[model samples]
Target: MSMLNEWQDYLPDFLDGLVVTLQLTGVSLLLGLPLGLGLALAMTARRPAIRWPATLLVEVGRGAPALVVLYFVYYGLPQLSLTWSSFACAAIALAFTTSAYTADIFRAGISSIPVGHREACQALGLSHAKELRLVVLPQAIRVVIPPLVGFCILLYQGTSLAFAVSVPELLSRAYSQASITYQFTATLTLAGLVYGAISLAAVALMRARWPRRTPTITAGATRPPEPPTRTHPSWETTSERRER
Candidate 1:
């Protein structure tokens, strides 16, 4: 009975925090995914000048811990005369992390294309840009949908780290409530259950949306199997007669 009352009292605040959480996540993905795609392309560029710097950025973003990155954006950037609100800092930090991590995912999807497809495009007189635009990317995106969805789930959970920067996300709300009511266990348990529920639902949706078969390298280009060879009885009899 008391637990029910506690939930009713705190649920509204947590929901407000959840709204913030979703906003932060949406903003980060909107900013991050395109940057991630660009980084993936840059990392795979033909020139070292383009590729090396992109590689370094990807490495640093992936190598650093998420909390450390958040702290760097929220606190450290102010030292360089660059300042932002806690919400902005959190969004920027998470977006940076998202771009770095998702770059590799995008790169793997792009690279999974069989070399033959690119050569075929070249033979058809398509420019590299056209080949990528018309052929490679469409297929790569289809191959990558499942992993991208999985990454989004991770990024959603990772928004909790923004609380350290005082972004008023879900974890921060739970902490604030716990501190005030001295009900750390109950408040935090509810917060965790909420997170779990959303994450599981996202995973279920991804599984349902994920393609059942491997996407073909190119549309309408599946190769048919070769016909089996068979010897006719007449041919076998002729051969036997010649042998006799």
Candidate 2:
């Protein structure tokens, strides 16, 4: 069969795999985001005991490759008597990586909050938790959202790594089909196209939804419209200038 025709035939299986891929992405994000926020808060805590351990976890997670983490969860954990399903293993590993990376993002967002705001909260006799819940976090959430969304896109693409653990995601399905048809080129090409199409569509939608805000220049915004050229100053008219 022609490659295009073959692609059409294989599309159904690929779509099934895509569903699994989305599920994995959603699960990882669901589990990771709150943990990431907690890590961010801990890393920013005044207590050294709290901050140190969370910092170490963030470092190790960020430093390790996702494949290694996946392998550790899927393979090493079994020996340690913590066996989990392949899907669960993949989700946990990916979620760990997600939380680690996102912790820094959350930290940056939280740090972006002005010190004056914190001081104002303190002056109002707000507890630390209340201040974060009411004032800091609300503002930080807005700052973090765009970056968080971008990271989510990265996480979605990274889900293909589950193929190593045999979780049967999009890439795994493509490889399975390629092995059977011996049409590696055609099968993989279709998979790449599928991934690219989804990613590009997401990017286009993100741009449409959150278009960059260009500064709007009104008539007096730049230089006060040159103060109307002062043809006849209110305090000194043309006749007054002649008299002077």
Candidate 3:
């Protein structure tokens, strides 16, 4: 009963924190996904100038730990006279990290297109942009969706890192409550439960396979009779002429 009561108090605050966490995730993805696609395109370009810079950015983003990046945005930027609110800083840092990682995923999707398809597009006299917009991207989008959803789940969990920068997300709320009530175990446990529940739900939903419909024949169903073929005048038999 005591634990239940503790959860009851924590639930409201934690729910509010969850909202912030979701918002941060949405903002990060909104900014990052398009940027990631652009980077992927640049990375695949034939020109070294275009590809090298994008490659460098992805390497740095993927090479560095997210916490370090978050710290850089929150603390280091102020030295350059660039200051943002904690939430903004967290969003920017996470977005950069997301773009870097997703760039590879996007590149993989793009590369999965068959060489024959591009050659066909070229033979059709289609411009490079048209080839991508009409033929390549449509297929690539489908391929990338499953992995993108997986990444989004990871990013949702990653939003917890924002708490380190005092962004008051779910984990931050849990820690704050723990500090005030000194119920570290209870608060932290509830927080973990909440995170686990959401993550598990997302995973379950993504893994669900919708039943596909197939043609079925009923007991009394029968195929319709074929139409009779008329004989051609030049090929009609003498017996048919006699009957006429």
Candidate 4:
């Protein structure tokens, strides 16, 4: 009963923090996904000049920890005369991390396409841009959807790291509440349960929307033979005379 009352008192603060967390996740994904797609495309460019730099960026983004990136954006950038609010800094840092990690996922989806599709596009005289727009991206995006959803869940959880920079997100709110009431276990446990609940719901939604697989032929099942072709009259006459 005391716990119920305590939760009622804490609910408003937690809801406010959740709003901020959702905003951060939405903004980061909106900005980062397009950047990640561009980087994925660049990495696949035929020119070494375009590919190398993009590859380097992706590698660094994946290699560096998200917390380090957040700190760098919030603390390190001010040294260079670039300054922003804590919220802005957190959004920027999270977006950078999202782009770096999602780029690989996008790249894998793009690459999984059969080479024959691109070849057919080329044979049809389509430009590279047209080929990707008309033939490639449509297919790749379908492959990427599930993994992208999973990544967004991770990024949402990662928003907790922004508490270090005083962003007032979910974890920060829970921490503040615990610090004041000295009910660390109950408050933090509630915060954790909130995060887990949302994550599980997202995963369930993703599974529901996931593409269904088509059935494939089993081993030992032979394909039907090709039909016989009819010989032309001209070829038949020439061959008959030569035989005579």
Put the candidates in TM-score order, highest first.
Answer: 1, 4, 2, 3
Give lDDT tens digits, candidate 3, residues 23-42: 99999999999999999899
Off by over 4 Å in 4: 211-244
Angstrom error at residue 48, model 4: 0.8
TM-score of 4: 0.86
Model 4 clash pairs are: none
**Which ten residues in a row are the worst by lDDT in model 2?**
224-233
Greater lDDT among 1 and 3 belongs to 1
Per-model TM-score versus the true fold: 0.87, 0.86, 0.84, 0.86
How many clashes does each candidate structure show, in the order listed?
0, 0, 0, 0
lDDT of 2 by residue, 1-244 (tens): 5998999989999999999999999999999999999999999999999999999998888878889999999999999899999999999999998888888888877877767778889999999999999998987786677667767777888899999999989999999999999999999999989887887787778779877553233453332111111112122235533532
Residue pairs with clashing backbones, model 3: none
The C-alpha lDDT values of all candidates are 0.82, 0.83, 0.81, 0.81
Write out the backbone clash pairs for model 1: none
Estimate the TM-score for candidate 2: 0.86
Q: Give the per-residue lDDT digits (tens) of candidate 4, residues 51-105.
A: 9999999888877778888899988999999999999999998898888878888
